[model samples]
Target: MKTRITLLALLTAWHAQGQTLTENSMADSKDIERIVVTGSRIVESIDEVPATITIINRQQIEKQLKVSPELQTILATLVPGLAPSTGTSSNSSQTLRGRSPLVMIDGVPQSTPLRNGALGIRTIDPNSIERIEVIKGATSIYGNGAAGGIINYITKKAHADSKFNGQVSLSSRFSTAKFEDSTGQRIEGMINGQLNNFSYVASASFEENGLQKDAEGDVIGLKYGLSDAVMHNYFTKFGYQFNDDISMQLVINHYQSEQDSNLVDVVGSVNSGEKTYAIKAPAGTDAPGEPQGPNNQNVMLKYTDQALFDNTQLVLDAYAQKVKNTFFYSPVLANPEQGYDGGQSVIKSDKKGLRATFNSLFEWDDLEATIIYGIDALNDVTSQPMVDGRVWVPEMDMENVAGFLQSKWLIQEDLIVKAGVRRENIDLAVQDYKTLRLCKSVDICSIPMAVKGDTLNYSATTYNVGVRYNIAEYFQPFANYSQGSDISDIGRLLRTATVSDIADIQTQASIIDNYEIGFTSVVDNLRMEFSAYRSTSELGTTNKYDPATGVYMPVRAPQEIYGYEALAHYQLADNFDITATYAWVEGKDTKNDIYLGAKQISAPKGSININWSPNELSSMSLTYLYVGNRKRFDTVAGEHVGDKGPINSYHLVNFSGQYQLNRDWQAFIGIENLFNQDYYPAKSQAYTYSGYNVKGLGTTVNLGVQYQF
Candidate 1:
C-alpha cells in the first residue's frame, strides 16, 4: 500500500515538472485518416457511422495496462453495454447490449461454445493488440451470429517505415486487492522491418497466470480449479508493394493454452420438495460430482490485395481459420449404482472446424460504395468415449454453410443506405453403434439414435436503411432497421434417428429481427449518442434433458426481447475528460407460460459508467451495474426455485497515474474498487446451478514500470 502511495506522490511531482514542457501536438484532421472495418465494407470516419461504436485505441490500452490486473476487466468497465464477467473456462462468452456478441481477430471468426475450453475472452494477451474496435449495434456485413454487434481486435502489422525496429517487454503483478491476491508474469517481443517494396513484421508473447481470489478471499476459478496456466501467441505478416496503385499481403496468427482441470461443486438439497436443489448424479455419474478439463487452439490465415483503375480504386481480402477443442469429464451413468464393482473413469469430447470468408470495396462518382459478400462453412466433429459413465455412441458431424451479400451507398455527403441478405444450409450426420455384451452372448440394450444425414436450409434477408443528416455544424440525427438470426443446436434432441430414417429427419433455425433509431451530436470536446430498439427471437428448438429416458427433448415455443441504450462522452479540456452511459432491457417469452424464458439468462437493466482523466496526473473510473430480479424453472415439472432476485447493485472505483523518473522511463500505480463495493455480475449462475451465485471480484491494486526509447 505504501509503495502505491509513494508512486502517486512521485507522479504528482513529475506531472508538475512536465507542465512546463510543450504539450503533445494534436493530430491534424487530414492526418487522422478515417478508420474503417468490415462493419460496413466501406471506409468511413467514426462519426459517420450510423451504428453505435466505441473506439479504444492503443493509447487507452497502454494507460489501462499500467493499472488494471487484466485487460478483460478493463473492457467491461470502459465500454458501455459491454459487460464481460468472470467465466469458468466453458463460459468465456461476451455479451453486447444483453446479447452474446461475436468476436473476430482482424476478420477471422472465432467458433467458441459450451463444448470448447473455458478460457474467457481475456485469455488473449493485450500486449500484442494494436487496437480494439467495437460496434455496439447489429451488423449485416459480418453475416450470421453478429446479432449483438462485433468486436474486432486488430493486431500490430509491419510498419511502412524503411527501417528495422524491435522491442522487448517483461512485467509482473504480485497482489490485486487486500484479499484477492494474484501473481502473473509475461514476456513479449516484436520486430518490424521494411525494405524496397517489401515489409514484414513478427511478434510473440508468452504469459503464465496464477490463481485469483475474490474480496472475501474465496478462490474464484476463472480457468477451472487449477490456479496456474500458460498461454502463447504468435503473429507474422508480409506485405509487397508492386506499384504505386497495387499491393498484396499475407498474414498468419496462432494461439494456444495449457490449463489445469476445472470442477463444479454440486451440493445436496438446500430447499424442500421437488423445488429443492440437490446434487443428483448426472444421468451416468458414479459419485456425486466430477472434474472436467478445458483446452483449445486457434490458427488463422489471410490474403489481401489493393488495386487502382482509372478514377476508381478496389480492395479485396480473404481469411480462413481452424479451431480445435477437447473436453475431459467424468461420466455419470458408469457409476450410478453405488457399491458397484466398476469405478469411475473420464469421458472425452473432440470438436474441430474451419471457416472462410471474402470481401471487396469500391469507390467512384459522387457516390462512394462498399459491397461485401461472403460465406461461412464449418464442421463440428465430436467423440465421446465411454468410461464407466453414461456411455453414448461417439462420432458426430455437423456442418453449416452460409453465403451473404451487403452493400452501402453514399447518395449524398450526409445520406447513406445499406442492405444485406444471407442464405444458409446446415447438414448433420451421425452413426449409431451398439455395444454387445459378449459375456451375455447377446446385446443387452441398444440406443438407436443418430443424425440420419439430413440438411436444413435457412434464408434471411436483413436490410438496414438509415439517414444521417447534419442538422448543424455540431449535431447529426440518424436511424436504421436491422435484423439477425440464430442457428439452433437441433442435433441435441435428434436421438430417435437411424440410417433408414435419414429421409425423415427434420430441423429448424431461429431468426431475430431488430428495429432501431437514434441521434448523436459532437461539439467542441463533447459527444453524445442515443438509440432505441426492439428485437425478437423465434425459438426453433430449445432442448431439455429427460431424466426418465436419458434423452433431450425440444421445446415448441419462441422468445422475444426489447431494449434501448444512451451514451455520452465529453473531453472537458486538454486537462480533463468524462464519460457516462445507460441501458434498459425488457426480455420475455412471447409464446410460453414461463416468465423468464431464455431471455432470463441475460441482465435486465440499469448500468452507469464514468471516467475522469485530469492532466494525466491521475485518472479514475467508476461504474454501477444493476440486474433485475428473475425466475427460471428447476425441472420440466418442478416450479421455479430461488429466483435470483434483484441481485445487489454495486459500485466500482479505480484510479491510476504514472511518474516519470527520467525522459525515457516511468513508474505507474493504480487502485481498483476504491470503495470496495460488493456485487454480482449479470452472468452469475445462481439463477439455475447451485443456489449460491458467484460474486464479483472486489478492490485491487497494481504497480508497474515502462521504458520507451
Candidate 2:
C-alpha cells in the first residue's frame, strides 16, 4: 500500500507542474515524434495508434548491450507485462501477457509453430538490432501464432550521410563475487556507406563466455544453462533507389551460438531444503562435441513503390529462414544393439514466405479515410530427431494462406475509428512415426503405438475494431476489441501421440478474444498511459503431468485472463528524468475452478528507472525491479501439490554509466545486482520440486570501450 501511494503521489506532482515547463523544450519535442510499425502494417506516429505499444529505441538498446547482449534481459525491463529472464539459454517459462507471443525480425516471422524449439527469441544478435517494437494484447494482423502479441526486431539500416563510416567495439565481462575463471570477452565491427543510388551496411561479431557462479561462490547448475559458450553473428543489408517513387532492399543475417562444457550437473534434493546444486568434472575422456545452441540463417527481399498509382502505395516482401537447435546429452535407456549409452536431440525448422500490402488515402468533405489490404503466403517444415538417427517428432509440413483488410476514418479533428478483418487457411501434413519406449533396469515396457500419416486442415476469421477520442492535448481516450488464433503446443501433441490417425487427436485451433480500454496523457514534460484488458478463450490449452507416461501433455479447457497496466515518464529537471511502470495480471480455468499454473501466469511486477545527465560528456542510470508475492493453491495434508505453489517477493537494483573520453573513443560500465541480494527467481520458486529449477545470477560487472571513425 505504501509503495502504491508513493508512486501515485509522484505522478500527481508531475501532472500539476508539467505545464510550467518550456513549451519548446527539446525533450518534449523528441517524445511525440517517435514512429512505430507494429501497431499497424504501415508506419505511424505513437499518438496516432490506439493500442498499448512500447518502443525500445537505439539509445536504450546500446545501453543494455553494454551490460548483456541477451534479448530476454533487455525486454524484461522495458516491457510492462513480460516475465523475468530465467538465466538460461531457453525461454520456455517466460511469457508475454500470460501467453506466448510471436517473434519476428524485420517483419519476417521467426517462430516455428509446427515444432516450437523455444529458440525464436535468441535468433539474432543484439548488435544488429536498430530498435524493438512491442505491440500488446491479442492481434492477428501478421497471421497466426500471435495469441498474446507481437515483438518486431527492426534491423539496422545504412547511413546515407557518409561515404564510408565504421565502428569497432570490445567488451569484457566478469563475476564480481569470485573472478577466477568467470571472465568473458567480445569484439564486434560494423561498416556502413552510401554512393550514388545504392547503400550498404555490414557487421560481424564474435564472443566467448566463461563459467557462471552464484552468490555463495558456488558453480551454478549447467543443465540447460548459459555458461561456457561461443557465439558468432554476421549481418548485411543492401538497398537501391530506382527512382523517387520506387525502392528495393535486401537483408541477410546468420547467427550461431554453442555451449561447450566439461562438467556435469550434480542433482540436489529439494524436499530436504537443499537449494544449492553443484557441477563436477566428468569421468570419461569423450569430447564435448558440438555446442548446444541454435544456428539461424535468414534472408529477406523487399520492394516498395509510393506512386503505384496516383494516391496509392504498395509493398512486397519475400523471406526465408532456417534454424536448427541442439540439446545437451540426457540419460535415455536405449537398446544395447543400437550401440549408444545416451543420446541428444535436435530440432530443425525451415520457413519461406511472401507478403504484399497496398494502402490508399483519400478525402471526402469533412472526413479523411485510409484503406489497407494485404495477402500472406507461407510454407514451413520442421522435425525433431535424435543424434543417432531416431525420430522423436516426425517431420511436419504446413502451408498457410491469409488475406486481410483494414480501414480508418477520421471525424473532423477529434475522433478516429478503425476496423479490420482477416481470414486464414492452414494445411498440415504428417507422416507415420514410432515413439521411443525406454525401460528402467532392463525391464520390459509397453511402447505407445505410432500415429499414422494424415492431413489436417483448419480455417479461422479474426476481427478487430477500435475508436480513439482526442479530448485535448493532454489526454486521449480509446477502446479496442481484437482477436487471435493459434495451435497450442503442436510439437508436444505429436511427440506424445497414442492415436492411430490425425482425426483421433485433438488438433483444434484456439481462438482468443480480447477487449481493452485505455487512455494516454501528454502534458509538457510528463507523459502517462493506463489500460485495462480482459481476454478469454473457449478452448484454452494448459499442460498437465502424465504420471503414467512420465511426460507432460496439453489439455484444453475454458480459460479467462484479465490485467491492467500503468506507465509514467516525467522530466524532473533539465538533467534528471524518471520513469515508472506497473502491471497486474490474473488468470483462471473456468471449467476446473482453479487458477492457471505459473508457466501460464506471472505475478504482479513493477520497475522504476532514473537517469542523470549532469553534463554532455557523461551519463548515469539506476534501475530497480520488483516482483510481488504470489500464492495460488491451498495446502493439502501439509503438502503443496499443485501446478503453482507459493512464491515470495524479490527485488534487484542495477546501475550503469557511460563516459566520453575524446572525439574518437568512449567507455562504459554496468553493474548488475548492485546490492548483491540473494533470492530465488519467481519461476524457480513456482517449480521448486522440479529438477529444472536453478538459482539466479549474483553480482556481475561488464565494461566496454568503443572507437568510431
Candidate 3:
C-alpha cells in the first residue's frame, strides 16, 4: 500500500511539472507526430483516440527483424500486457489482455474463429510489413472475433522518390552453443516505383531454419516446434489515381511454411522437470509428415472517393482469403477397419467479405461533429479433415450482415465525446457427418457415432462510448466503455453434439464488456502513459484436457478480469534515450471461485530498452525483460492439485546494432539471449498434463548486409 501511494504521488507531481514546462517552452519543444488507423476506420492522430494504442514504425520493425524474423517474439517484447511466445509457429497459450485478439493483414481477418487453429500470428512475413498497430481492450469496430482487441499489419507502399528503386539483402544465423548443423540463411528482394498515375510495389523472400539447441548443448525436441523449416513469402500492391477525388488500390499476399524433422518426442518424468529429447523412432513408427505448418493467401481491392458530396467521404473494400494449417501426426490408436494406422488432421478455411463506409462533417451554432456509418457483409466456410479423406469436424458455412453508426462531438475546444453502436445478424449451415473412432485392441476402443446437421441463426448488438479532455498540449485524460462478441468454438461443439437440432447443443456466443480509464502526458523530452481496465463476460469459456479422449473440451462459466499498464520514455542525452514499461493482469472464474491459470493470467512483467546513436551512420540498442513470480496453486491436504502448481521468474537480454558503411551499403548484427540464460517458458512450466517441459533457446547470433540500387 505504501508503494502504491508513492507511485501515485510521483505521477501527480510529474503531471504538474509537465504542464509548467509546456507553458514556458511551448515554442522550443515539438510534440511527436504519430498517426493510427486501427481504433477508428479513418486515419487520425494517436492522441485524439480515447484508448491505449501502440505503433511500430518501419525503422523499429527492420531493427527487430535483424535479431529474429519471428513476429510473435517481436510483439511479445514490445507490447505490454501480452504473453510470451511459445517458441513455435502456434500461439496456443499467448493472449492479449487475458483473451485472444484478432490478427489481421492490412484490413482482412486471418483468424479462423470457427475452428480456432491458433496459427493466425504466423500468417505474414515481417520483411513485407511497413508498420504494425495494436489496440487494447474489447472493441467491435471491425466486426466479429475481436473479443480482446485488434492487431493490424500494414504492408509497404510504393515510393515516389524515383522512377525505379530496389534493394537486395542477405543474412545468416547460427547457434553459438552448438554450431554444427545449426546454421540458417535468408534472402530477400524488393522493388517500388511510381510512374504517371500508376504506382506499384513488389517483394519476395525465402528463409531456411536449422535445428535449435539449448544452453547445455542439447538439441531441443522437435514435437510441434518451429525449427528445421522452410518459409516463402510474396507480396505486391498496385494503385491507380484516376482523378484528384477518386482512387483505387489492389493488394495480394501469399505465405507458406513447412517443417522437416527426422526425430520424434521422448517423454520425460513429470515429477523432476527434466529435459525432453527427440530421438529417432523405430523403422515402422508413424512420424510427422512434411509441410506441417500454415499456408495462407490473401487479396484485397479498395476504392475511395473524397468528392462524393460536400464535406463527405466514401470508401469501399472487398477482400478474400484462403488458409490451411496441418498438425503433426499422432499415434493415438490403430484402426484396421478404415485402412488407416494413425490420423493426421488439417484445418481449412475460406472467407470473402465487403465493407462500405461513409463519413460526413456537420457544423451548427457553436458545435462541430462528425458522423460515420458503415455496413459489412461476409461469407465463411471452414472444416477439419484427416489425410485419408475422413471427416474430423464437418464442414460449416456461415453468412453474416452488420451495420454500424459512430459519431464524435467536439463540445468545446478541449473536450470531445464519441459514441458508436453496431447490429449483427448471422446464419450458419452444416451437413450431416460421422466422427472418427480408433481401436488399438478389442479391450480399448472408441465407438463411432453419427451426428445430425442443422442450420442456426444468431443476432447481437454491441456499443461503445468515450470522452477525452485535453487539458494542455502535454496532458490528456480519457475514459471509455466498450463491448465485443464472438462465437465460441462452433466446430468443436458441432462435432461433439448428440442431439439432432442445433439449438439443443447448449452452445452460445460470448459477449465481453470492457471499461477503461487512462491518461497520457508529454513534457519536454519525456512521455508517459498509464491505464486501468476491467473486462467481464456473463458466460466465459474454459478449456480442459480430457485424458480419456486425448482432446481438449470447453466449458462455460462466468468470468472477471482486470489489469493495469504503465510506460515511460525519456531522452537522457543528445545521443541516448531509454524506455521502460510495466504490466499486471489477473482473472477469476466467478462460478467456480477458482483463479484462472497462467494460460489466461500472465505474470507481472516489465522491460527496459536503451538506444544510443553516436552518429548518423551508426546506432545500437540493448533491451532487458523480466517476468515476475507467479504462484496460483498450493498444496491441499498433502496433494498437488491445481492447474500446474507454480511457475518461477525469468529474465532475458538482447542486443542489436547497425552501421552504414556508405550511402548505398550497410551491415548489421544481433545477438539473442546474450547471457545464455537457462530457463523454461511459462507455457512449458504450466503444462503438466503434457508430461514434457521444453527449455528456452540458448545464445544465437545473426549477421547481414544490404545493397541499395
- Highest-TM-score candidate: 2
Q: Show the colliding residue pairs in model 3.
A: none
lDDT of 1 by residue, 1-709 (tens): 2332233223222111210111121123222223545466443455556666777777667666655535556566567666544433433333566455666666555534212232335435567677677776555455545656777776665554435876665666543443332676666778876777677777787766555445654544332322355667777767666664455666676665555423233322223211211122355554323333333334444333332333233444445444443333322222222332322222233333333333344455556665656666655554343344433433446565667766666554566666667665655565644321111112222244433343435555555655566556477777776766654333333433333444554445456666677788777787787887766667633334344444334554565656777777787666556677676555556686444432223444444545555544445544554445434344434533333333334455566666665765666666655565555554453333332345455555656665544
Whole-model lDDT per candidate = 0.51, 0.78, 0.78
- lDDT agreement of model 1 with the native: 0.51
Q: List model 3 lDDT by residue over 1-709, tens digit each.
A: 2332233223222111211111222332222126565676765557668889888777778877888898988888888877887667877667888888889987689988888877888988998888888899988888878877898897876665456899998999889988977799999989988787777888999999887777776667665576678999999888777776677888899999987767677765334657675656678875555458889999988887765787667778899999989876655534667667776788899999999988776766556677889999999899988766778888989898999998877665567788999998888888877766765444555555676777788789999999888888588999999998788468877665545565677667788999999999999999999999999998777765454555455667888999999999999898899989999998999999978876677778898988899999999989898887778876455533324546788999989999999999999998888898887777666665443377778888999999898
Q: After superposition, how far is residue 295 of candidate 3 from its true place, in Å?
A: 0.4
**lDDT, candidate 2, 1-709, per-residue tens:** 2332233223222111211112332234254236566667775556667788889887878877776778987888778988776667777657788877889998898877677766778888888887899988888898877878899998876665677998999989888877878899999999987787777889999988877777766666765667788899999988877876677888899999988877666655333445645565656654343568888899999888766887777888899999899877765435444555566788888999999988777777667677889999999888888877878888888899999998877677468888999998999888877766643224543266677878789899999999999889798999999999787467767777777786788878889998899999999999999999999998887777555654556778988988999999999899999999998888999999889877778878899989898798998888888889889877655655434667788898888899999988999998877877777777766764444556677788888999999
Error of 3 at 161 (Å): 2.1
Compared with the true structure, model 2 gives a TM-score of 0.92
**TM-score: model 3 vs. ground truth:** 0.91
